[model samples]
Structures are given as structure tokens and as C-alpha cells.
Target: MNNLLIGYARCSTDKQDLQIQRETLTSLGVAADRIYCDHGLTGTKRDRPGLTQALAAVRGGDTLVVAKLDRLARSVPDARWIAEQLTERGVRLQIGASVYDPTDPMGKMFFNILATFAEFEADLIRLRTREGMKRAKAQGKLRGKQPKLSSMQYKELRRMYDSGDYAISDLAEMFRVSRATIYRSLERTPVSR
Candidate 1:
């Protein structure tokens, strides 16, 4: 059998289309049968079902093609880890934007440098976000996320507790709140009622 040329494509959300990426890979001589795609899934996650299946299907001489590096993974660390895994298994990775072949020495060097930069960029973003949150907290402007249930919802919760038809767990699920919230709401009910 001919050495397989597998392609992987991913989009962050269901609203985004994978058509363009799929077309690009298909135009690059990758066959339709060998393409795996994950829709409505974040690239940061390592447990992508389509990606896992594609990786497993590849053999020693097979080539794994991605439209771009970022499409495969969100961070440099993840990219590097995936590259290492493919290399150890004698599989080749071909980034459509670059001519670097992961199996080649020059390609490996280039990929490592790129991965390092990616890691640095991710760390910088995280640091900036943390610093921003800290400043907000110091200014007493950070109230955190707003409460999910409104005043009306709280009233309904009280009524539901009074009716005594549903269990606390059921009320929690129906109202999309925690059991603790339900218990607290029930506690606040007037003794006469």
C-alpha cells in the first residue's frame, strides 16, 4: 500500500467552517479518505477525538498534514509534544505554510525555534491578564462573575421549596443553581409559611 497522507483540520467553534482548510489540504494532494476534522472544539485541548484517530491511523512512513501550525494546537508546548510523538513513531508532519519537514535536521531546528517563541508569547499573554486582574482587585473594581440567578428566580426557588414537590438536587438542576443556594434560599423562608 502507498504511504498514507493524512490531514487534520480544526475550528474553535461550530460557527466556523472548515471548508477552506479542507479545500487547501485537498488541493495539496491529500486524499478525501485520509482527512480528519474536529468541529466546535478548542485547539488547546489535547483530547480531540478526530486528531487522536488520525494520529493512530498513521504508520511509520505516513505523512500528517495540517493547513497551519495553529490549526493543530494553540500553544508551542503542545505543538512540540505532538512533533516529538510523531517523530518517535516515524511519522512526518508537514505544515502547509512552511517547507520544513519534521523528519529533517534543519526542519527540526526551525520547528524548535518556532515552538519556543510560541511558548513565550502564551506566557506573556497569561502574565498580562493576571496583572490586569490584580490591578482590578486592588481598585475594588473586580466583582467577579455576576450571579446566575436573579431576584425573580430566587423568589421562584422559595415557592418551589414551599411546595415541597421536588428534591433539593432536582431544584438545583432545574434552576441551574447549586444545592447550597437552594438550601440557603429555603433557610430564609419565614417560619409562619
Candidate 2:
């Protein structure tokens, strides 16, 4: 049987478009139907349905095509593991227009270099995000999920609870809030307030 060119594409977030990668794969001669994709999945994540399907779809003599090494994997170990699997199965890896020959020392070196950079990029992104969040928190702008009840509403809820006439269920119904919310409010406020 003739070898096939199976393409794999991925986007880390749902907002990120996969059309460009798909077009690139098509331009590289991979059939549209043979292209697989994972949407809203980061390369750091191990469980990717598209990557699994692409790996399983490739047989001996078939080639797996990706737009870039980073698109295939963001970690060195994962990249190496995929390369090894392809090598053992007699499958070729095509990154962009170039076919990676795992047996070649230069190809192996290149793959490793590319994988390291991909991992580095991912690390840098994480660090930057953490720093941004930290700065926002310090500036008092990163207050996590806003309270469901307004401060005035909470005071009123507490007042109703302190009346001794309203049960927790009655207070929740009166406030149009959950019983758990009522319980939490009661826990936070001392009686007679």
C-alpha cells in the first residue's frame, strides 16, 4: 500500500484558530480528511485526542505531518517519545516541508534543539502569566470571584437571621439565595448583630 501523509494540528485555547495550521498541512499535500486536530488543548497536556488519533493513524511507511515541532509537542521528553515511536514503526515525521530522519545525528540534534525551545517558550509564558497575576493581586485588582451577595444584602440577611423568627431555609428563600450561602453568612457573622 502507498504511504499516506497524516496531519496533526493543535491550539492551546479555544480562541486560537486552527484554520491556519490546517491550511498549511493542506499546502504541504496532506489530504483534508487525513488532518486531525485538538482544539483548546495545551501541548503540556498529555491527553490529546487529536494527537492520539494522528499517531494511531500513521502506519509503517506513512508520514505524520505537523506545522511545527512546537505544534507537535512542548516538552523534550514528549517530542523524543514521539520520534522514537515513529522511528520504531518505520514512520516518517514531517515538520513543515522537511522530513525528519531520526537515524541522522544532525536531525536528532535539530529535533532536540527545537523541542528545548518549545519547552522554554511554554515555561516563559507560564512565568509571565504568574507574574502578571501576582502584580494584579498586589495592586488589589485581582480579587477572585466577586461575592454573590452585596454587602448591604449580607447585612440584611444577618439581621433577618438574628431576629430568631426566620429559619435558615426561610432566610435563604427570603434572600433568594442558596441555603449554603445563608449558612456561610451565619457562620461569618456573630449573633445579635
- State the C-alpha lDDT per candidate: 0.82, 0.89
After the best TM-score superposition of candidate 2, give how far the Cα of residue 36 lies from its true spot, in angstroms: 0.8
Model 2, 1-193: lDDT tens per residue? 6489999999999999999999999999999999999999999888999999999999888989999888999999998988888878888889999996765778788888988998998899999999999999999999888777887888888888788888998988888889998888878766654
Q: Name the regions of candidate 1 deviating beyond 4 angstroms.
A: 117-145, 148-193
Each prediction's number of clashing residue pairs = 0, 0
TM-score of each: 0.64, 0.72
At residue 83, candidate 2 shows an lDDT of 82
Give candidate 2's TM-score.
0.72
Model 1 TM-score, 2 decimals: 0.64
Supply the global lDDT for candidate 1: 0.82
What is the per-residue lDDT of model 1 for residues 1-193, given as tens digits with 9 covering 90 to 100? 5467889999978999999999988987799888999999887799899999888888888888889777787787788888887888788777784545677898788778767776676568779999999999899999787766787887777787678788999999999889998887667654324
Candidate 2 whole-model C-alpha lDDT, 0 to 1: 0.89
